[model samples]
Target: MSITDKNLGSKAIQWQAHQNSNSEVPENTMAAMNYAWNLGGIPEIDIRQTADGIIIGIHDATPKRTLSVPEADQDKLISELTFDQIQQWDAGVKFGEQFRNEKVPSLKQILAGLSEHSDRQLYLDFKQVDLEALAALIQEYGVARQIIFAHNNHENCKTVKRLVPEVRTMLWIPARFPETAVETFTHIRQTGFDSLNMVQLHLPDAEEKQSWRYKLQKTFIQEALQYLGEAGMELEVLPYKFDQEDLFELLDMGIRRYAVDEPSVFVELLNRYFN
Candidate 1:
């Protein structure tokens, strides 16, 4: 499909801000996400639960990378601390002086801000946490329809489905799926997830990079998509960094949605290509 208005789907394929679209800053923050969204990108929060069980937008097993912390605490998981402790973290100073006052936001807080914008869409990368609390917030804000829940576990995805029946959910397709194309489709169907998110198969490794092995792998992806398309399933792929050629290959395979960290770059390419 072309990256046309039609192919891009109901809304433009906005860039999912990876970690608030800023690396040094703790992601899932209002500042970082808003910064990107204001610049015409979509916010994708990687959320996790704290030791005290509060839901917040966070990625990584520890707080070091995003939060300013001593090297000793670098490996400490967010689960080791309470929500209050997490909020006290230097969530933004490392990123820049402008964001120094920014603090980690609770899920409810983020939802509250988003409630104001009718066009705002959030793609949440769930870290297999319980969705009951999150579901309640979405309901309270009346934005259940604006969220897309993405998770790697079948049960977790099922939980999202059960808690927020109206929300769309994507199940992660493991690196090693069933042996054959038919088997892959069967596996996905069995999970009963509404959609899927998978790793992009086009990357380095010269021998298999663009040769016979690479072509064969791409063939399998195409076959799987064919079955999924016929069965009314949708696949979204995200590569850490996808070059122009990578975009064309994925497009040739009928792939549409892309969850890229640098969404503006890709979106610009898509616009240029489609126009």
Candidate 2:
């Protein structure tokens, strides 16, 4: 099916909030997701495994960027810290004082809390964890169909399918695919992921034509959409920044699944520009 057919389903486009409405405050925090949900946006969170193999909602591999940590402890990877130790560090202070009380939420906490919103679609991005363990957690919560699991490893995806075939899955493509279209498609097909996601990092103000990287990514993704669509895979893109005309261009290109940080902004933009 085409990206349009797979994602849009008669809507203009489906927008997922990056790291759960991260454009507002402390990213990957429950508050961000709550705001996103209140605004009619799909919540997205990246899960990282702690030292003891517990899953937590954290975007980066470490707490250096998102959490308040001693400079000496800045280099500690998520795998090096226990979930209790990891949660002790304040995840909200760096953003502002109002959210200073926020702590990192465990995958279990998020799943247990949000499972009631059966219609709310959640994206769970795996950083470095066993898919089987993650699958087990989802199964325990009885939310296998409500969550979309994402990872870059094709082997991991295959394992996820083997372990929990009912859970939805998405593949993450990096900035540089570094292979022929056919070769990439082969890997994607072998993985049997239901959807694909890629990040578009561009300065908000720069002209789309001024950046060679943007041009390259644009060309690559355009072809990728065609290949995946023909092979019955859907595509989703996380645009770091966008404007009304720019977004309109993307929609015209048949991109129906967008990963935008500010869902309310896009909602308003779409309502004002198209209406």
Candidate 3:
């Protein structure tokens, strides 16, 4: 199958409910994943291994900020904590005053809950764990085809390829990178990545800086279109917030994939524009 056929399915909406202030949704919780799945959007979650070798759904290494772990005693690495000790801390209580009662979730529980929706896609962001385990888990669930591994670490991407060659992988770019699209693409190709994932804000830099943004504006959506046309690489643009004009411009430029936090707004935009 073609790369796009393997990577792109329906228009994707990423529910970062783990960071939501009002939802009281714990990061990587079954409740959070279920909420995203129920919204008829794709569920994206961050994964990290606890000290005990159990893969749990958390974004940070320490439980201090998001859990009830004492500040003085929160120095334990995730890889060193057992699941039972990890579960003892309340992740929800520290999730701002709004969501003061959320619970931490295990990756297995989330996957088991998500297994019912065979058609939906999942974007797994590995924070601090071996990609091999993630590959094994995906393979175990027979959902390798429906998941995408995104990471900034090239080694992790390589590891994923070593473990699951058929699984799609994207190189994630931080907002501060100072490379042009050509330079970026060249780097990605050198790293043996299948695609590029970038924030929408990164596209608008001056020529002195990375000119991806200027290029997109000058050619409209044709900038990325031309990139894909020339290099045959998939593009996944992540927009921080829903901006109708920006979304329209991206759609006009031939970008079919987007990463968004608000599914309801994205679905509305999709229905009005693409549907």
Candidate 4:
């Protein structure tokens, strides 16, 4: 479970493509995922479950804007709709050109596709209650060791670990409030988390007219890394934007894991330095 002990360190960038839709690159679709794999970057996808227990790839709890559920019916939660009903809504039309005609995919479909390609790793973000079932599916596919489950809820992490102990888990801390970084890390550790999923903004504030905050953040990162190293856990940092300098700084600190929206760009940078 230690950073050094775990085989989770990868110089490859973890790319989270947006779920396949019209305007943005439909993330979590077979096409987008394959596109990422072909670029030699790991694919990070989001998952939610239908009321009937079928797991689907999506980021939002409601199918409102993404799927164009009518304003009157937009309040329906994913958990309240059956898989068939959920699939009836077009998850791709809203985005227009970028996604064109892609469709939302199921968890089983994504896993099967991943199984065919062995060169890439999967970063599965569980955004629903059926995570227990998803965990079972992952184990059934023998991909527990190849996928990392990211969840904001501590209990979800515990559930994944208990159901699939061999699989790695990262605690996803929301960075909406910048002041809670330290407290979040503490909670992660207390929850027996194996890794940290923090945002770039959570880094320490800089002094006026100086990059001192950057330096201070770097020092704090090293300390946290060391602490996690000693405790047999890993640290995965996700910057707010695709900044190469930030990635390089973290890499220089001996942190090899990262999540980025632009996988192609980050992977190119990583290959330049590490490959």
Candidate 5:
């Protein structure tokens, strides 16, 4: 299959709901995944391992931010606690009382939930977890092709690819490293990371008008795109916020895939282009 097929299903333009569509539901929770799935969009979730080696979806190092944890246990790390201990905290109360019963979902739970929809794909953000174990679990669930493993760590991308050759992997360029974005792509080409299925480019924060936030020069973007196309790798953009001008510019440049936090806003603007 082509890189696009490996990474996502057949769609003229596709988006992975960043943090599982956090704008409408709690980020990285099953509720968020279900919401995105209902909308026929892919859910991008962050994964980390518990003390007992069970992989779970969560963004931060601690549950203090997303869960309703007390001040006394604010510093507790997910890695330091067993899955059972972490499940005691309410994952949705902080987001809203209506979603109060949402528990921090384990990777198995996420996979099982996904099994129901064979057409849907998942974007798994590798935060801190065993590559082999994670790959094995995905294989066990028989949904390797339906997953796109994403990570900022190049080594982790390579490792996961080595473990599961069929599973798609995305290497996201850090927005903080705008100056070296092209250099990073050049390094990927030179080093022969052929196992890589896709590269995620971060567009500068539209609301934040800082010079450093200016992601990459246009020339650099073109060069990177040329190289990626030649290498048979797909490019997915992560614009921190939705902007009409920026989205159109990217569309003009031939970028069709995106990782968006608010799918509704992105889709509304996208519809304008087609309709």
Candidate 6:
């Protein structure tokens, strides 16, 4: 099915709030997701399972970046820690004084919030988690239709689809070792991934002066639109950083979905220029 068939957003084009609009709130926390939900953007979150098999919303394997972990525990992975142990660290204090006591949230917490808002949609970026447990939890919450299962791993995406066909799946390509749009489309088709709902393309860092090979040019966008369009899969772009020119160019090329750190800014630009 095309993205248009999904209830992700009312707009034909959608802006996915990366890391739950981290520019406004702490990354991968409920606060960030709430902010993104209020802005009518899909809240993209990274999910990992703890040692006890509890799924939590966190990006890194370690809590060092967004959580207040002790120096001694800095190198520890979330998979090695129990849920109770991992939740002790403050998730928001490092971001600002206003967000001092925010605790690490679980996948259940995120899903509970999504269940409240029928219009809300979530982009679940798969990390280290049990797909069966995740799928079961989503089913239990009756949020199977409200979340997008996304991962760089094609097998995971396919597995989730097999587990819950009602849930939409998105496969994201990493920026490292970039592939041509035709090559990407061909691979997706050959591998049977073209049957999925969406395929996300990574836009290289706009300000990067060095990595010319990683840059996604206008021709690449056009080719992606053509080939992916024929394959019946929607293509979404996630940039390393927000760039207005690049975004506008993509809009002109008929690419509508984007995962961005700045959701409010992207919406404003969309309204001013394309709306």
Q: After superposition, how far is residue 221 of candidate 5 from its true place, in Å?
A: 1.6
Ranking by TM-score: 5, 6, 2, 1, 4, 3
Off by over 4 Å in 5: 1-11, 206-213
Error of 1 at 227 (Å): 2.4
Report clash pairs, candidate 6. none
Best model per TM-score: 5
> Which is superior by TM-score, 4 or 6?
6
In candidate 4, which residue pairs clash? 1-232, 2-232, 18-27, 19-26, 19-27, 20-26, 20-27, 22-95, 22-96, 23-95
Stretches of candidate 2 above 4 Å error? 1-9, 176-213, 217-223
For candidate 1, the per-residue lDDT at 267 reads: 66
Q: Estimate each model's TM-score.
A: 0.80, 0.82, 0.76, 0.79, 0.90, 0.88
lDDT of 3 at 244: 72
- Against the true structure, candidate 6 reaches a TM-score of 0.88
lDDT score, candidate 3: 0.60
Ranked by lDDT, the better of candidates 2 and 3 is 2
Over 87-129, each residue of candidate 2 has an lDDT whose tens digit, in order, gives 7789898889999889999889889977888867788877777
Which clashing pairs does model 3 show? 50-78, 51-78, 51-79, 51-80, 51-81, 52-81, 92-102, 203-213, 204-213, 221-253
Off by over 4 Å in 3: 1-26, 96-101, 180-182, 190-224, 229-233
Per-residue accuracy of model 5 over 127-228 as CA lDDT, tens digit each = 889888999999989888899999877888888888988889999987666667767777887876567989988876634675333456667777777777
> Native-vs-model 5 lDDT?
0.81
The residue-by-residue lDDT of candidate 1 on 103-205, one tens digit each, is 8888878888888887777878787356787888789899888788876565676777788777777664543322443354466666643434332232222
Which is the better candidate, 3 or 6, if ranked by lDDT? Answer: 6
Candidates 2 and 3, the one with greater TM-score: 2
How well is each residue in 133-173 modelled by candidate 6, as lDDT tens digits?
A: 99999999999899899987778988999998889999887
Indicate the residue-level lDDT of 30 in model 4.
Answer: 62
* lDDT of each residue in 1-275, candidate 3, tens digit only: 01121124653434322233323245565556766667665566788887667788777777666678867659777777788887877766564555555567777776675566677667777788766777788777777777777776666766786788766676655444434544555565565444333312234334463423333344533554455556655566655544676676666665766666665566677666644
Q: lDDT of each prediction vs. the true structure?
A: 0.65, 0.70, 0.60, 0.64, 0.81, 0.79
**Could you tell which candidate, 2 or 5, scores higher by TM-score?**
5
Ranking by lDDT: 5, 6, 2, 1, 4, 3
